[model samples]
Target: MNLADVPKEKLSPMMQQYAATKEKYSDCILFFRLGDFYEMFFEDAILVSRELELTLTGKECGLDERAPMCGVPYHSVDLYLKKLVDRGYKIAICEQMTDPALSKGLVERDVIRIVTPGTLIESSMLDDNANNYICSLYYGTDGSCALCFADLSTGEMSLAVPQGTTDLTVRIMDMLSRYTPAELVLNAQALSLKSVMDFVKVRLQCAVTLRDDACFSLDTGRELICQQFGVDSLELLGIEEDGAGACAVCGMLDYIRETQKRNIARFISIDVVDSAETMGLDLNARRNLELTETIRGKERKGSMLWLLDDARTAMGKRLLKTWMEQPLVQPLKIMARLDAVEAFYKKSVSLMEVRALLDNVYDLERLMTRGLFQKASRKPHRVT
Candidate 1:
């Protein structure tokens, strides 16, 4: 169903509008806002109908044959969207900008936001204990690479620049395994790097996105970082503008703004992660150890985390997993963690009471972050 084959004059006014919007977002499934439903037409209609098991229907456009059509009720759109996103499909949510009843002609509609695997924030679409991270990778010509990880649901951003490594690929893959990002955004250089791209797309099975090269420029990155942190320069934050980390962060921020279609006030600061502080485990090592899941079935059973985890809340389980992946290298830090464990062991009664209290608690970190983002965007925030 190529629209290019159909003459513009043959399309009805409303369908002409859909064609124009769909042209701009050809990579995504455009959910065109119609009265009480988000409708799909032509290719989108046919594909969505089969995927969601919706009835295949037709509509009278200006053509001799009716246009293929299907739709889901707008109120229950999240369920359909979750299914599509989980299947690795991107969606462009076309929303009506004005009331149709008040308009004299066709209602004006535009894509308000894009929903991707990385940018998901709805509670129903996410796992409570896992962070859905969207990663940005910037590969410099000088053999340096920067990786940035951000969880849109939690508003947490962190960057890692692995330097002085003989095999940068191993370090890069190690970081990727630790975070297990749902999506990866790359610059021109990074996209051209065949090894990294293959590992991300094939081994990790992550969605890859390419943005404009200008977004990763050094000067642009510095300016965006300064503006985001309300600082005069990168020096104030101990970050070099020419560095790989800055480039990665800048590209990430640009990508997020593009998908979200608005400024994100959630990122108040950026954390520069020091890889030396923790024991570095490459991809193979993590897989062999089965730190989080078994290597065979990739399930939580028979894994180190499964054996050790007794967390009462979602946040605690996530924190435990984070700790398991990044073991502290410093003796003082290790001793501090052991001391805390010893204290909890000595006061079993108090620990039991604390666990009981945590059982009633929700994931406050993401809950509050989603509330703030929604309020800033002036949309309803749903947290379960």
Candidate 2:
């Protein structure tokens, strides 16, 4: 096959399979595995090379004149993957499904794993004390979908049903602050829900999916919630909801069950907090100051593990998770923690001393494993 003979409009079957995988994982940088190296094609090549600092090469695809390609060795995928993820890119890991020697036709390829900022479970890429979150969206029968999220690492769970388009953005922003989920899932037909999710994806550098089967009916949500909690109704949990809320709640539980990490989220708190009531911080500011970057160089010196070392009680650990998850919200809670630190500082403790105290806090997975962990303790010391 020569480059001049390749058709421009339609792709070949192999290329079509690649395109399908790419479309299914548009939000992710699809690491399409061809052989020893994880190959990326076309725009994915451009994006991955630029992000992962790899050499941009080209590969012959039938008659195509060496289509753009870039790749990383399978052994070193984690480092490049972490770099891309740290820079906020979800990666869909496409692997060879069958042994090439055993297969008669083109080597089988399938996406065995999808890595998102929040849904990361790999120990090397995560902190031990942190939580990873996956968000689920369920619209009611009346074109209303509730957003429910859970982070199993720290056992944080929350649900919110946006009333209309006007509330959807704010509701999502609020959830962003509270959960900071790595991935978001929504109903396929929920266009409004999808739009809101897209906005969040752009803002948070996260992954979003539209799954029709995931959205449960209102009665179904209620039934799941009741069954999970072993209660007759939601009223037992002090949850007062119309039919819509019931469905949303149930859809959330169903997703959690399907994910097969039953004990990951221990149901610490559930509330109907309005986004308007919370302080507004854009996604960029939140991610920079809280997650990837430090408020000051001094605080970055220690491990998150060290910070939690002094947390003697379960309540303290839970408080630590809450702070990590919603770093920008609950000002009163953050202030209290700051006040505690200030008291320690007042005892002739040098800033370097505090930095040294935090030096042992190094569990990235544990720190970010749950949705409720916050890094406010390391914020620059406020005088007043």
Candidate 3:
């Protein structure tokens, strides 16, 4: 069969299924597993090859001609996946659902997972000291809505119901700092709220989930909460809809149930406080003063992670992780941790001085990557 003579109208069942899957997840890079490699086709092939620095190639699809294709070996998927995610791309992993040897017809193909930066669970892609968050919003019957957000990695949870304009910004900002959610959910009717959410989304490169109009009711919020936690009613959680707070809390829990991939059996104790309870810091100050920006680059050999290595004790390492999880909260706790850090700094024979340090360390992206990869050259003695 000639290369150009492949019948466009006579595509095999497997080819048809692949085309349908491609259409279903148009926005995502579909990693279609064929055998040893995760393959990309047509435009996905071109785009992925260029972005990932992989070789561009083609495959014979049992037709008169070859189809455009590019692929990376299954074992090296994590490396390429990390690169794509770091560049802010969502991936839909489409695996062959059935064994080719056992199945009679075309090999079954289905999307097994959708990977995003914030939803990542692999230890290599995540920081032990940082939290990955997913958030959802529910608009009530009135002109109000509840925002629910959770971080499964660290088991942190938070809720906020902002009524007027003043509280809205404060609440949203507070939630942003408190949870650092990677994705957000909201109803279509909540345009104003969506605008605020969008600002956060773009600035933080977060994902958003817009609910259908049919599910925009307050009862839906409660039902979602009940369903997520597998409770018969909200009463079991000691929460009632006396006001908007319950709806907000329930909506967040519901969002978590729908989106979270893992069964997080344990939750870390979260100390809840209003934005007013803590001193407000501007976005610039928060990012710069706290060293949040240092962790944005390559995984290992970053600055924040470097500081964590020199933390000297388990408590210090735990504190460092907590700082990355909720960079804006618990100033007192951070100060206490800083004191411990300072004691170590003074005693250690490092060239850097302790007196020049600021309240919150800056260049966070650098710090985190460095700390994540830190390892001792030799085994240390185990102390009793």
For 1-384, candidate 3 gives per-residue lDDT tens digits of 321234545665666666678777776788999888899876778888899888888766656556678898997788889888777777888888889899897888888666766556554566544466666666656766566556554455665554434656565665565556676666675556654666676666676656665443456666655555567766665455445556556545544443343333333232233444345544544555444445356243455545545443333454565555445457787688789768866777442444234213432432332233241123321111
Clashing pairs in 1: none
Encode model 1's per-residue lDDT on 24-100: one tens digit a residue: 99999999999999999988999999999999899988998888899999989999999999888899999999999
Indicate whether candidate 1 or candidate 2 has the larger TM-score. 1
Q: Better model by lDDT, 2 or 3?
A: 2
Which scores higher on TM-score, 2 or 3? Answer: 3
The reply for model 2, stretches above 4 Å from the true place, is: 1-13, 137-147, 152-176, 182-242, 246-319, 323-384
Per model, state how many residue pairs clash.
0, 41, 28
lDDT of 2 at 250: 60
lDDT on C-alpha atoms for all candidate structures: 0.85, 0.61, 0.59
TM-score of each model, paired residue for residue: 0.93, 0.57, 0.67
Error of 3 at 116 (Å): 1.4
Cα deviation of 52, candidate 2, in Å: 1.0
Better of 1 and 2 by lDDT: 1
lDDT of 2 by residue, 1-384 (tens): 322234644566677677777777776788888778888888889888787677999876654366788888997787888788777677888889999789898788988666656555444565434456677766655555567776554445666655534565565665665666776666665556554656676755666655655356554566667666667868776566565556556655665554432432445356654544345555555545544334556243353534544553333444565555455466776688799788877876575676565554443323444323232234322111
